[model samples]
Target: MRIKKYSFLLLALLAISFKSFSQDTTQYIVANRKNSLAQQNKPYVILISADGFRYDFAKRYNAQNLLRLGSEGISTPYMMPSYPSVTFPNHYAIVSGLYPSHSGLVNNTYYDRARKDKYLMSNKAKVADSSWYGGAPLWVRAEQQNMLSASFYWVASEAAIQGVRPTYYYIYNEKIDMHNRIAAVVNWLKLPPSQRPHLITFYLPQVDHAAHLNGPESPEAEKEVHFVDSAVNELQKVVKTTRLKNVNFVFVSDHGMTKVDNKNPIGIPAAIDTSKFVISGDGILVELYAKNKGDIQATYNELKKEAKDYDVYLKSNVPARLHYGTADDWHNHIGDILLIPRAPKVFNLWNNKKINPGWHGYDPTVVPDMRASFTAWGPAFKKHLVVTPFENVSVFNLISEILGLKHTDKIDGTNQLANKVLIKKASKKK
Candidate 1:
């Protein structure tokens, strides 16, 4: 195990000088690219994300397909997402091995002081722009080494970060049915070895939409969980027709959802002065960006004075363990002042719009409900294994190890997860 890791680590680092672009496009491809002969033979990985799937959803909803597959492989009690466990940040964290703060995606919608612009998840222009993203995402790393990748829709998958997007990918769209999506994967697998994707990302959004619209405990949420379970079972069965070997599935969720106190939500804090600071964030958390750095302390103190259901802090004092403080904000995009509400309470900035019943974006360390789910099943994994909860960043290490792709940059994740869940042979390249 050590030998394989050491070999990958010792190789001369690669220096890339190419440029790429990603606009409002779908069924995208990077022309003239073919997986290196060495990479064409690597084991296949289908990384699927069932958004808002709680750790216990399968068992609670009796998702027999997922339960059986998980029992046949490895399932952790739960996987802790990074602080402020929201979709975009945590999903990007999973692929990049960097916390949301480190990755510069502090929230689903955040203002970058340097760029003087806000990146909203709803804005397709910003979503497709690679400049907002940081760190070497899994697809970027794979392509850097000449291994092709594909994505059906996941955070940063559409952006051409580091001048590389997945070789085959579609921009985010909800219109595609499960039948067509599975067929696309099947077709990709049937491609010639050199043209086939070694790494593919497939996302399922039904669970999250239901959980957010109706409370996670509601019938609609439970129905979506079953839907995802049946969908995965169908996907696996269809892929089996190809009779291909070494196809692995890492079923995961970005973050879990919990019922919040929407009826009596906290309004915008009186301490915030618009002239002195710019504001961002929503019900789960509120961020105040100070126009002048010296004003931060006073605002933080004032917010603390009026603070009731929420906790206020200067960016410098954000919990060190959460890696969200000023020191850890690699992209300088984090707000100067942050307000984190206690669970069941969320910040209502406008004091007008109705808040959702189910919500996330709390520190997972303190709110267990924010924790996500993870299960590894396939030819590359050891049979019937269970391990303790791990951080979402650890997934970056696991994928690289499985595909024998070397990472030239430093990452927050380590080989600990890969070593524990993957069999020894996983480290040895085919």
Candidate 2:
């Protein structure tokens, strides 16, 4: 009788401990998910994003590990960010193969017309609400096909997009140490084949945070760059312990950063009537969401006339290459008028005494400094190959091709990028 009682107490204690562990991890694991037989044998991909890591960061900072790894496989001169060159938008673009305008995450902060709510990156509630997001991210794509995925951190990765989240994901937080973050990914790789994740996304925000706090070229930002570089190297070393033969890595940045003229920031345009138009955006890009449809034309005309240093454009007149105008605004998140500032100058609606010296959110085509970085190294990629610059949207197609996942959703990325970087497969994935 005593033995039975002791065993019951032990079991209860174990259950309580397990629950405690799960809560500590802050991980949300979907129940009863296992990769399909075909998916089980597919190659593994770990997509890493270092926010605000510029195209020249590796070379400029001498990130030896990254330079060496990039050389081991395929890399590009630079990767163009989707229109608006901001964080939330471009990160979603890389995973979803849809430009931010098309995906509804048109900016770091955008006002959704239909719902009449704002999606601010800093608002924890909105950032986690899946309704604010649309594009079928890579993890969502993999989960739909019964291939498990994991995310250390990625925009919208915490949200359940299309009724699915990565099989193993954490509600993004900065508390976890970089070493522990990489360990979690390694642990995912060490899981049993039937339950293991085939797709994983890891994000590092140190570089971006430092760059924003101090100019991108500042010593503080450079130290963070080296930290990220070493972290990537450490992750690769840890991943090898799993001995998973086909593990692949793709390193990229959401957008690049630049030093802006924060001392003499431009105030809200004199022509803008706050009551008539809702203002959104930061630093380099300013958007005007008109309350009344009729007000758009008149307001745009006024802003265009008074515009100095910044160029004003009607949504329709925005350059077609940006894919961000009325025609491309699939969810109507874009404003009727866009105010684009030349580099070194940004808008300050709040009339703040000072703003951060580093900023992005510019048109990459115009401000070459806004180009993001991309490099891929794996058994699947060609070795020591350099390619021309490609749009960030194409990263989605490249990973999709690698995992052999078929995406029925409409996407802006083409298979051309995957073809150029990836090696010809000996046999198609079943």
Candidate 3:
């Protein structure tokens, strides 16, 4: 009997010891997680792109939250998008820090010579194919450095570029409402320290879509501006409620929009046969690919003479300021002759009778309508900082710096431009 009692007592002692060890292990894990989070010192960087948002729209409309962000954070007079200034190229450029020329996404749709394939944005297979996208995107860079990243609806996030994707991403779905998008990001931010993303990208296309359908000055565009602003305000509220630490917000646009007057459309000149050249792009920028390489010069001469409201140039002779054809592989896909229309005018290659009311894709340098907006607010940025106009390419470096991630050496953006908005840490006196 005594032996039986002693055995039970021994078993009970073993159970108590195991329970204590398990508790200790759990506490150790919790402590380590806290320490790990504390050691990370890096801020959560939120990149928000409002497509087709013109720089002047902010001033014209009463975007309360947007204006408040500008007043509280670093605001630039404008951000000049890379040439072509289209959606896909500029969005990719903002993330990759490379010009569209070098990035191999010179236009929204282009032929890949090596692959002998055409890429169209509307084509789901082409859009998701990683081969169509070049240059290391910010998400890939973040993951490579062992940091988690997420994308709500950013371009190229759908593609598994370089066999890497953001730690969490959703395929582009336009049907998803604005509230859901903002809520999804907020939820990601609320994850445990180990699972939360360091970098998050959100895309709001309502303003751009409205701007494209209705002119920038129209009530439709104005309503979208307010809608997007409210969405941003909600995001700020969610973050504030969650009490997230060291979070930064970057607001930008891929490009702007311009009103296209259908009453006076610039039609393709009759002197040049449009059938002979493979035409790509729309609106202000047109790429004419010579069917026969030998006929390139003749084509250029004809285009120059025929085009009244536009300037025509060979790929090699495109203006240095535009930086359109600097890439080595430009000849593979770039048009033999480029056509750019003067501002407030767009090329009408299609003979459709229906009036297209609004458009963009203009030369950003001379066209004020093509300029995009940029604002940065967070712990990392200087308060009420107003910076000189800078190019959108610099955004990549700014994001990399904010996330404490290293960018590839081939990038065109310099750190000097991004430093203008960053808070200067006080130096210790010698």
Write the candidate numbers in order of decreasing lDDT: 2, 1, 3
lDDT of 2: 0.84
Off by over 4 Å in 3: 1-40, 271-275, 326-331, 424-430
Report lDDT (CA) for all predictions. 0.83, 0.84, 0.74
Cα displacement (Å) at residue 161, model 2: 1.1
Worst 10 residues of 2 by lDDT: 13-22
Q: 22-76 in candidate 1: lDDT tens per residue?
A: 2333577788899998887789899999988988899889999999999999898
lDDT of 1 at 303: 81
**Residue 306 lDDT in candidate 2:** 91
Clashing pairs in 3: none
**TM-score, cand. 3 vs. native:** 0.87
On TM-score, who's better, 1 or 3? 1
Q: TM-scores of all models?
A: 0.93, 0.93, 0.87
Residues 226-309 of candidate 2: C-alpha lDDT, one tens digit per residue: 999999999999999999989999999988988988888786777888778777666567777888989988888888889888
